[model samples]
Target: MLNPSHLHRLFLYGSILLSQVLPLAAQAETPEEIACYNDVQGKVAWNQKGTRTWGEDNARNLCKGVVQRAKRISCFEAGILSHNNWSKAISDCAQTGGEAITAIVPGKQCIYNRGGYALTVQWYNPGLIVFNGGDADDYSKYSTPGTPFRTEKIALGQTSCTDAANRAAVVRIIGQGFLNEGITIAVGTSVGIGTGVLGAIACVGTAGVGCPAAVAGVSVATAGAISAVGLALPEVKEIAYIGVPGSTNYLDFSGTAWNVGISNKVPLSQTRNFAKESAQTVASSIKDFVTGGTPGPRSITFNNQAGYVAEMVVIYQIYKDFGNGTIIPIPVTKSSGQISLGFSKHIDIPVEIANLPISVFINGVGTTKNQILGATVPANFSGNRCFKSFGTIFNPQSSNCN
Candidate 1:
């Protein structure tokens, strides 16, 4: 379980980072901390510039406008400032920066959950529809009957995503849905889907949330094909991001013939948004795509593949994750239980599948929050096409699947 974001030597540096943010907050309580909030932009932040010569007015102007008063010190971590004009703020201003990771996977950024979990994503260009217990690696043969669809910000219902625990569990359920039906995760690896329910860690298999039989208001007969992940979280935070925009089309394409690639970057940022649109746009929505709908890159009927009839996006109340190492957790509720950790906990986050040409790095100390932990190295990057060891042993143009 070595972290891939940094080198092996960096692994020694892992202990350098305080494991818990709470302890760091406690140890770093300073009178120089200041909280700032820009109501106009909905930005909530804390500042440590109070130790300098800056006054309250100077702090406000320097940190931008705060609706209330700024503090001179002591417990300034409540996040953002309020009007009261006092020497003390409410929150721990020790950790001054927001986590905005710009690496790993493709879709968007990974959002850290203080609840001991996170939301990660993967981008799939043209995306792919994979099956349960199927190898997600074979993007070329995704449509070749019996293969499962790649997971995207799959589905969501009329639930609320504010609850971090339920959110994590629901996302795990989505990964589980594919499993109970016979699969796991990664576009193509033994690493089960993602980590800690969201993405980029380790997923537990126990009893947790259940899929709402309906997705985007339409009933999806799940027939009890998903697993239960009983992961309870303690915090929620943000992670870095980069890559492409996500769409159920990515998931839908997995069930089609178009060879899709990975890396999630862009995001709609709301469950309602992803669900409302994916239901209509993504081909997996049996109610829509099976009947009539607008034809596009996702709607085209291919003679090579049959339409998806049962496998549907089941997670709901999403937070829009584009899996650039980010997965907007879909918060669906079932009876509460813990992800039994029933099986091996080594389930890794999927390694990058270089199906498309892209750019950028997955920036993180490799030990930081939202930075995916413990992934097997020498992750196979070879994909789709049939090349050779030294050169082309056979036909260079042939399929690797062949």
Candidate 2:
């Protein structure tokens, strides 16, 4: 017979093996692992692989949330404050237009598109048919778990999210859309989408029949709310915005949204979005807010420069990065709305954060014909944050990145 000590030893070994095997699901989401998942939300592209290993991922991923399509009627005015003293020591700040009051005013329809999915219907209402779509992975779909689906819905600015209107269903929820998944189409609506990607040009009746901006499998979003939260992270990893540090990683892009910036040889916008949503604020992610639903822009004339821009917004404020995804927005200073921008008038917006470096965000809108002719901006590498050390150089307590 085996001695008692030998038996005890065997039992211990067996127990260790069981512990490792049994808690696979539990350990898969340990405090460290959960932290890693949350880290990648703002730093990694939603479509790209988030983690190769928990440690490698955790050590690397950092920052807040994502950016979105027009997401707001995100006009030039919105990027600035209606009033501000423009001082790092001063906390005076306020949003312009929709940012001033998103509760219900200046209605902007937004539509999001899910790239991969089996089938799903976000909402079924005929009242508001303005189209909009966005990528959704965290939400549970019947056939797929983490795979994102192209979803469509009417935004909250409407009479009511659940309220109905006599309008026809502009966005369709057919069983199969471009990728054979659920789809939303906003027909004649406008505003609340910035990126130039979209599925079909929005027409009157049908979705695919006619759709709208944000290049197809469109990506461009925003948050109606803004919070001057600090990035509160370390600079352990070379400070990446959406991906890594590089001029090409400009910011505010999803799916192939980078393509528009590439083909034009310009950076993306200076805008960054909230990667997720919170009870206190509304983010760009569709899962956080089920509500939705436009596309417009054409021609080009920056300060009378037929081909390029001449002026820019020197003031800037670092807004919160929710959970949707990251993006590039036009550069601006604390004293924003300083530039009176009109469609086709070229302007420039530059920024310098925390004495790190200077980045630029170009501005200009075009006619309704040349949909992708507006100005572009790149991510503020100077503002690329990754750690959360309290009051450290990497952690400024306010929107004062500079």
Summarize candidate 1's per-residue lDDT along 1-402 as a digit string, tens digits: 756766756865665665555574565312212333222112323344333333444344333221111221222434334533323343233222211111123333222111111223332211111112223222221121011112234222112122121111112221111222322222422221221122222111123112121121221113221111111221111112111222211211111111111222223353333323332322221111121222232111111011111111111233456869775544432211111100001111123332222211111121122211111112243321111000011101101112
Q: What ranges in model 2 sit over 4 Å off?
A: 1-5, 20-22, 25-210, 217-402
RMSD of each: 27.1, 28.1
Clashes of 2: 96
Q: For model 2, state the Cα shift of residue 391 in Å.
A: 17
* 349-391 per-residue lDDT for model 2 (tens digits): 2343232233332333332222212222333433222110011
lDDT of 2 at 297: 25
The deviation in Å at residue 295 for candidate 1 is 33
